[model samples]
Target chain A: MSDAYAVRDNILTHHFSDGSGCIFFDPMDNSMVAATKPVEELLNKEKSESDEQHCHIINTLLIHKMITKL
Target chain B: MCRRIYGDRFTHSIQPSEFIDFRIGIKYPNFTRRFLKPQVQFSSEGLVPFTPLPADYAFAMLEWGMNWTVAMYEFQRVIIHSAVLAKDDYAILLPAPPGSGKSTATAYLENNGWRLLSDEMALITKNTTQVTPFVRPICLKNASIDLCKQMFSHGTFSETAYKTHKGDVAHMSPQRHSIEEQSTPANIVGIVFPQYSKDILLDIYPMDKTSAMVKFSENSFNFNFLGQQSFETNVHLIENTRQFELHYSDLSEVNAFLNEEFCK
Candidate 1:
């Protein structure tokens, strides 16, 4: 339902979540911001979303293809 | 006068503790009286005031503050020593001196159900690394006495301390319900050094860890005598906690803002 975000620097970083949503705090001015899932919490959610998940998928497929060649 | 303001009152009472005497009575606003009051010999000698105030009233006030200081150490497993408050598991440690409006902030926060850790001392056992809960009467001085009376309206405040340097301070005993249910061991989530300012909005800020430690040491009750033990405890606490400096004036706004910001 509600996620807890720590107040750090100028940006809010991902901590832990309930898979429902996440929360973040602005350290510069101390404000609360929330990131919700299935809406504004996915890759389509923000421009700064990490690409690590896609890279992992591609790496797994590459490994599978190499095994087939062997 | 008793060497310092703190010396005279506790001289006869503090003899048996065997806790180290670091001579740190006034430095730390929170690491206050180490133990409670011993039975006073009113008809004997010293601080014998003939101010028409009842002996029971004066004796009880002194006993309450002193006993409160000890209740923390003896029962450190259940309370948080920090000055801050939160809505859920939220807590903040505010360490400041007398005129900083801490009482005003505390009254406001408790009204919001943040729970009172202690208005006097922040008890921490050297080994357990936890804060102890001390739910006693909240002592308010001078103008704050009147202000709090107006604010709480129905609070049971003791007769105000008369002819004292800090002014006619009064202790407001918490409701029976609060005293019974307001005890918990909170994590030291954040540290704040509050400097009250009027006309300012709510400000949630941070402080560097090392400097915060030094400030905390200065705020210790028996740190000097405890020597290495107190030093070690300070180091561990600073490492495990977030530190900050809060400068604000309005209690209602700060209270609402912290509940929203830290608890949610």
Candidate 2:
């Protein structure tokens, strides 16, 4: 687990109660990013960075300005 | 045409307390055009918003103009390019693009038993799952027009507008129950992305919330304009509703699936 990154300000995130997936709404650009359960876990800082797939997801989110370094 | 299509919705009498939503008119563009290869124009608040169509297309142009006016001016609610149908006070939002057989399915369902909230757009109040009724005629294109007429022989239909951009269009008057209950709003209980396929009998694909959200947003008419409020409202909607992608050729089977899964 790492607290090195945080969801950007004004970006709304909705996590499904059924654990299916989650959606992030970026108000700045009026864009939405849909993520799988693993990506949601990574964003919540509940998953380890050791997983290569998780690192890629974090990189993608950061590039899209959906997350920022804490 | 208005009398034939709108039925009870049309009247010469006006109540002082009633608020008119739009002041629209269909008239000949100019004096000469009215006689020579005649054409008609659609105007709202004295401003013409569309090119004049051949005189025969006057009624169709009016319908299109009304849709345009509402979509451009109605900002209090999030409007989606969808067909809204209800059963047992629960609304189902069918968001699909043209040629997806959405209007065809809507015609079938509304004539069968489902109440038609809207056939063209879904007006959803912000930050809530409730969909307000905007009951109006269901616009059917080309083949679907004849199909619907055959299926619902007792149904009222507008005169066909031949050789339009959407290819020979006509409007079907919504069931009387829909217009009678026009002021009632229904809570959304399901979202279905429907595609009509001639070969498929019925194929139901359950969509994850994330996927449903993305697809639903694409069909919205004013998603970006509403900004964060739209986002929150759509999120709330997806969270509360069951989502699916249904591909089928049979309307009866589709109706059965909807009734079994969402109507209860």
Question: Per-prediction DockQ scores?
Answer: 0.02, 0.69
Residue-level lDDT of model 1, residues B157-225, one tens digit each, is: 676667565666677765544454456755555566777876987676765554566566567665534
DockQ of 1: 0.02
Docking class of 1: incorrect
Each model's backbone clash number: 11, 0
CA lDDT scores, all candidates in order: 0.53, 0.88
Residue B252 of model 2, lDDT score: 94
Q: Tell me the lDDT of model 1 at B56.
A: 33
Which lDDT tens digits does candidate 2 get at residues A7-70?
A: 8877888887768777777888887777776444666665564777667767777888999876
Per-residue lDDT tens digits of candidate 2, residues B60-153?
Answer: 9999999999988899999989999998688899999999999999999998889999998899999899999998899999999999999999
Tens digit of lDDT per residue, candidate 1, span A4-39? 222223444332222434333333333333333322
TM-score of each: 0.57, 0.92
Clashes of 2: 0
